[model samples]
Target: MTLRVMVAYATKYGSTAEIAELVAATLRDEGIEAAAAPASRVADVRPYDAVILGSALYMGRWRRDARHFARRHRRALRERAVWVFSSGPLDPSASERDIEPVPSARRAMCRIHAREHVTFGGRLEAGAKGRMAKMILEEDRGGDFRDFDAITKWATATAGEIIALRAEL
Candidate 1:
């Protein structure tokens, strides 16, 4: 059977959404059928053979929509292969090291019995909404810190794992 994957994400300013799009695209390139969508809009997970859920991190926590999505789909998630990611940290830290998921994300992973969780660098360009975003820009601390290479690499590896798991099944 063809393995269908859903790459669902919650984003406040679209960065996480872009990451999700890239992940889905990479998975497709790796021969897995994948679709990217907003977590809030995904009311059903039964159609997907696996799920990769991501969220934008703010103030060291995941966006509310992402947490709610996990809560709403916890049972379905547990029955399928699940992975999670967080996009935040407006620095090269994520590219330099493996950052642990924030407390809430960790809990969600445990709740859903996710196979893995990853943290990716975030982007905060001009016109990004929020006072803190503006403040960071004012401080010259804002830039597109997302590492596309790393994102692609991770997605590729994830696709391989998903394929292997399906073969085992």
Candidate 2:
């Protein structure tokens, strides 16, 4: 059976959406059927064999839609392979430092016993505007500090875990 995976994310200015696509690509490379889309586009979870949810963290919290989706599907998620991640916390040395993944984002991880929960410092363009983006822009140690290599590695590892788990069934 093809392992169907849903890679869903909530993004404000498209960065988190890119992250979700990376995870989906990793999953697909592992011989699983994976797809990526916005959280708002995912109508239901019952059709997928597994789910990987991620969101952009704004001001120490995940996007609202990602939170709600997890809450709505907590029961179904508990029975399948689930993973979580958050993007958006630009630290200059994130490549070496262990950035704290938000607890709110990790809530679904606990509920589903997810294979992994990852946090990647996201990028903010030079002109990050809007009230929230502007606030995040105010923080120092900031720049486009996204570690693409590390992100791919995390996605691959998570995919490997899911693939191995699928083997048991």
Candidate 3:
């Protein structure tokens, strides 16, 4: 059976959206059919076998739309294989050193029983018009801190887990 996965993301200035697309592509490369869509635009999660949700973090909180998506789909997500990711850490040193997910977001993920939640470095462009992006651009450590290789690896692993879970079913 083909595993259809939805990579839903909430991005302020498109960085997280780009990451979500890359993840969908990587999952496709792993032989899983996947599509990426804005979290607010995805009205239903029942069409997919698995979900990979991500959001751009600002001040330790997920974008409001993403949080809403999680809350709206909590029931459906709990019945499927679910994974979560947070993007937005200008620090490129280690994923662990990045800021943690806000308390409420953590609680939402717990409600869905997300298999795992990974934090990836985020990108900040000087030209981004968002106030938060502009503020982040002014930081001394600012640059494109995103680790594409790591993102690909994580997506591939997620695909494997989805396939394994499918076998179990």
Candidate 3 error regions (>4 Å) = 95-100
**What is the per-residue lDDT of model 2 for residues 76-143, given as tens digits with 9 covering 90 to 100?**
88888788888887775557777666877777567667767777878887577787677666764347
Best of the two (1, 2) by TM-score? 1
* Residue-level error in angstroms, candidate 2, position 8: 0.7
Residue pairs clashing in model 3 are none
Query: What is candidate 2's TM-score against the reference?
Result: 0.89
Stretches of candidate 1 exceeding 4 Å from the true structure = none
Candidate 3's TM-score = 0.92
Clashes of 3: 0
Higher-scoring candidate on lDDT, 1 or 3? 1
Higher-scoring candidate on lDDT, 2 or 3: 3
Give the per-residue lDDT digits (tens) of candidate 3, residues 48-144: 9999999988878889988899899999999989999988887875455645566756986898888888888887766777666677667655677
Looking at model 1, the pairs that clash are none
Candidate 1 residue lDDT tens string, 41-148: 998999999999999999889999889989999999999999999999999999999999999999889888999999999999989878888898899988888999
By lDDT rank, best first, the candidates go 1, 3, 2
